[model samples]
Target: MSAAEFSYKLRVYIEDTDAGGIVYYVNYLKFMERARTEFMRELGYGKDAIFNHGLMFVVRDMAVRYLRPAQLDDLLEATVRLIDLGGASMTLAQEVRRGAEVLATATVTVACVERAGVRPQRLPRDMTDSLRAARDTNGN
Candidate 1:
């Protein structure tokens, strides 16, 4: 798939922060996860479709870089772009930004697997087609 970008907006709340009032390091991953979910949802892969098909996507590998801290009540935008697609896996580039300032970035690889056995499986044809068709003119 081409680099099709998608974004999801979120607000940092107390529950997402540490005692120091900054977002916890792992919470950035959570933000990126939400962005990916939204991206798939827009591609017609909602909770039901994902969980009911006997297959689901699971993160296989991830690398994250935290650049800045986000404070409580900060409005953040999490972005996802498909950078690579394979028969059974896909890699995404993700970022969490506060307005124009990027706070974190990640490269995530996810694989499709059977829900019961968790064994890797090829991506569904329709899902791959939808991902290839996805586009965002305003993702910038």
Candidate 2:
């Protein structure tokens, strides 16, 4: 995959927040995860299709920074951008925002692995092709 940023829109709900009505810190990761999943889905790999191929993607590492607090009922957008794609791993940059305000940002690395043994595996050719096409369409 190349450097194409994708955005997913979501609304903060009660379940996403703390008793103080602010979104929990870890939930930002979840929001970014959702954006990445949607990005794959847009490339024609839905959740079931992704895992059903006998291989699945797993988070290998991540670093996050919290910038601001998001309140319950806030309309949010999460974004995913491919920073690098390797034979068996990919790095993504993500951000969660409430309108113009960024709440958090993360850099995540995920590895493609066999589901059964959890061993690293190369990404499928078709998936890679589709991602490349998307990147080109998005201007790189």
Candidate 3:
């Protein structure tokens, strides 16, 4: 579970909230996805490279816990860390935080797949190597 964390910040808009001005629960997942995208991009796996490699990642499983609500116009940050690296999948620990308060947390497993048939594919070596470098476990 030890990994370097990356964070992305965004503001909650009216469209992201319900009639009562509370952020819709599903939007949290979107924020986490953005964070993961940025994390990978920072590690050199931009969207183009990933797609050009004939790979697409899909969420295989997710577990989420909601603790607080983010209202309209509120600033929120989504943080992500690579937790597990498997042959064809990886796990991410993500959190949506409003300032210092954690609003939601999630554990998501993403499967690497062939873009056309959705068959499982091996993870990119560069991606895996960078993830291992960023791993905080025992100072790597």
- The number of residue pairs in model 2 that clash at the backbone is 0
Error of 3 at 83 (Å): 0.9
lDDT of 3: 0.90
lDDT of 2 by residue, 23-134 (tens): 9998998899899899999888997888888899999999999999999999999998888778998888899998889889999999999999999999999988877676
Q: Each candidate's TM vs. the true structure?
A: 0.93, 0.93, 0.93
Please report, as a residue range, the 10-residue window in candidate 2 with the lowest summed lDDT: 131-140
Tens digit per residue, CA lDDT, model 1, 1-92: 33657889999999999999999999999999999999999888998998878888999999999999999999999999888889999889
Once model 1 is optimally superposed onto the true structure by TM-score, how far is the C-alpha of residue 120 displaced, in angstroms? 0.5
The candidate 1 region of ten consecutive residues with least summed lDDT is: 131-140
For 1-140, candidate 3 gives per-residue lDDT tens digits of 45677889999999999999999999998999999888888778888989999998999999999999999999999998888899999998999999999999999999999999999999988878887887764431
lDDT of each model, Cα atoms only?
0.90, 0.89, 0.90
Output candidate 3 Cα RMSD: 2.1
